[model samples]
Target: MLSRNRAAAARSMPGEGQRSSGRAAQRLLVALLGAAVGAAVAQADEPILPIPPAPALDARKLALGQALFHDKRLSNDNTLSCASCHDLSRGGVDGRSSSIGIGGAKGPINAPTVFNSSLNFRQFWDGRAASLEEQAAGPVHNPLEMGSNWAEVLGKLSRDAPLVEQFKAAYPDGLQSRNIQDAIATFERSLTTPNARIDRYLRGDKSALSPDELRGYQLFKAFGCVACHQGVNVGGNMFQTFGVMGDYFTRRGSVTAADLGRYNVTRNDADRYAFKVPSLRNVAVTAPYFHDGSARTLNEAVDVMFKYQLGRSAAAQDKELIVKFLHTLTGEYQGRSLQQADPLVARRP
Candidate 1:
């Protein structure tokens, strides 16, 4: 009942001919009808849905992946790692306007949080990577990021016999670049953040949201923010032009190539300024917002969205309420609230 998506509902239903009979069957039918009615009501009222439980993953692969994620050997200089930019303990981001990479090089775009990244239809702000495994390989070879090739990375990683053993334990063909990517991606898939206050409310716990939060949610929908930021990940399922209603780049000034978003990937004129909508889960802590990392706070980001994306202005009270709603999107990670994690202290080179 937490999801209105038919595919999600079908996935949770019992398989094949498992059924009840007689009074049990009749009672089951009644219960199901009631649930269906409730689900319908919820569907009409809410577009966003609760994150499902993490999929069961191989423990060995998960452990190996996490190790690889933190190992600086993946970088050419042995001074940077996946965790350097995506800090799992700190909302899965490094908390910079743009990421600082190996050898003190700076990346052009803000690093999107790795949390709930698996739910995104495509990886990266431009939607260039089709899967997490592919995305994993990007930074390692990016000149401004890890700045390493698989040959160099494997050569360094091979020196560690213990790490090689980890590879052997996790994959049939061990210590290969593909396996490393697989292991890292497998670990990343485990980073889903669930059980936020909105999730509880969506799951039929009416008291989960305070009156103000509820009002904020109502305003979020009424103001059409839900048009782009809906579904399970609450914004990752699709792509939209950054300035759907107005010219955000010109107004902001000094637009760079990164501001082109999907246009860089497809080289399509229509794709200019288009980007994959980022997930809002744990968004409160994953600032500053947007690919440029221009917004310093949620309020500023919301104001920008209203002006450039919605082509409208909101009442100050309405905007404030919407910010309150966004705060409720922060959820738990590994049985702990994400808010409990320390904010990213910028690590300058």
Candidate 2:
């Protein structure tokens, strides 16, 4: 009886080890599968993408462009430069409801940020300028803005021997209006602000955003803000009617010719009030929001968007969260965060 019992015990012990090994393999498989699912979920959820680093451009052209951007001689009276409206140190905006140009003239539409302008499919608020080069020529020619024609600008700039020399060095064609535009456009292209907290998160740094900020981003997508404001520049890739869900201009009233938006360019009735959706990158600092520049604060801007653009209402808490998430989109320029470089000029949300 003792010998029979010993044999049975040995057989049972062998089966027990095999059973334990099988259970361990199953657990490992489940863990791997769970990890894969989590990754898939994360990928599926994120619609926005990270801003890529500025492309490698010619150093000579970039330097020439940077000089021309800040040179007030581009303006008629030498009072305003490109930097006057699109100040790089100040989130590439003048922080006004509408940019003030030469002789205290106020622009009709808000001056969109020069930062990341290269990423945009079209240049101005109405999507009138198709390229950065075309856009650069605009302000100089505009009567209310720089108030200078290409010929006048060339005459003024030619007086500066050093600038002419630099232009010649940068372009074989020398100091022409087209070359000037190219140089300024080249510098504008370099103004892209990458390395935002949201960008890091998009690049798989899970720890990049705080809990509330992450929640805000989720709400932003859930609430359909991402429909117009996605892609590398966050919102510059497309055009959408400002008041899709509601008549925004009617509510605001006093709609001007500028408010006609893309209609001015296309002359199509359907394109009325349609504007190139402005990029939300660094929006926290570039305040007095919208093409109309009506929303004075980021919070107000979000509210207006919810009401007019989405035609929906969100809780106060959700709106607050969305604004917080927007704060994460403020990115680094020249190795410094835009917030640090220039604190938000607008009142806090």
Computed on alpha carbons, the lDDT of every model, listed in order, comes to 0.89, 0.88
lDDT score, residue 36, model 1? 82
In the range 225-315, model 1's lDDT, one tens digit per residue, is: 9999999899999999999999999988999999999999999999999999999888888888899988877888899999999999989
Best-matching candidate per TM-score: 1
Give lDDT tens digits, candidate 2, residues 6-107.
999987774877989999999999999998788657755677778887899999999999999999999999999999988887788887888888999888
TM-scores vs. true structure, each candidate: 0.88, 0.86
The best candidate by lDDT is: 1
Which parts of model 1 are misplaced by more than 4 Å? 1-37, 40-45, 340-349
Model 2 scores what on Cα lDDT?
0.88
RMSD (CA, angstroms), candidate 1: 10.3
- lDDT score, candidate 1: 0.89
